[model samples]
Target: MTKEANAAYDSSWTFIFAWLLLGISLLISGVRDLYDPAASAWTTWLGFISSAVFLLMAVNGMRLRRRRRESAEPAGAAS
Candidate 1:
């Protein structure tokens, strides 16, 4: 694959991995909270922050992939 295709593939994989990680982390946090109702608020807040970061990373990766795809199209193509 060309450099642009490789970059797009990387970005897509990163986004998928980030989303998977975020989902797993959230599941663990939920289970932890259920197991211990008195779990520190900080722990919950940290999970929230981590998930947000992962979500942002995934979104940015998707945007990057989309841009790469658009740029790879022929210049004379209709908008």
Candidate 2:
């Protein structure tokens, strides 16, 4: 990959990883709530919001990766 492509790839993975981390954090929160059984309403709403944000980020990252690959196809085939 050229420098620009490499930078794009890295940024795409960064978004994916950030969302993944949020998901894992939410999972951990769920587990804690399960063990304690004293979770608050705020906690529940926060979890839902986090999930929505993660989904959005994941979809955006996927779109970005798809665009990058599709754009590279012609250049790759020509070479």
Candidate 3:
């Protein structure tokens, strides 16, 4: 693939990875909470916040990918 294609592919993969990481973190936090409901509450909250950050990163990555694709297109193309 060309450089632009590679960049797009990488961005897409990054978004997927961010989502996967967030999901895994949440899952672990949930399991921990189940094992120690009271003590693990803080841990769960931290995990939730981390997941939110990852979600935001994924959204930003998607936006960057979209911008890259738009810039790669010809100027005469419709918006």
Error of 2 at 62 (Å): 14
After superposition, which runs of candidate 1 have C-alpha atoms over 4 Å from their true positions?
72-74
The lDDT per prediction is 0.71, 0.67, 0.72
Candidate structures ordered by lDDT, highest first? 3, 1, 2
Tens digit of lDDT per residue, candidate 2, span 14-60? 66765776677677677877777576445666766776666666567
Model 3 residue runs over 4 Å out of place are 1-3
**lDDT string, candidate 1, 1-79, tens digits:** 9876776677667667666766766777678778885774556576567767766766787787778778878988945
Q: In candidate 1, residue 70 scores what lDDT?
A: 84
Please provide the root mean square deviation of candidate 2 (C-alpha atoms, Å).
4.5
Q: Backbone clashes per model, in order?
A: 0, 0, 0
lDDT of 3 by residue, 1-79 (tens): 9866776677677667667766776787788878887776776677677767766765776677678888878999965
TM-score of 2: 0.47
In TM-score terms, which candidate is top?
3
Q: Give every collision pair in model 2.
A: none
Runs in model 2 deviating more than 4 A are 37-79
TM-score of each: 0.60, 0.47, 0.63
Q: After superposition, how far is residue 32 of candidate 3 from its true place, in Å?
A: 3.5
State the local distance difference test value for candidate 3. 0.72
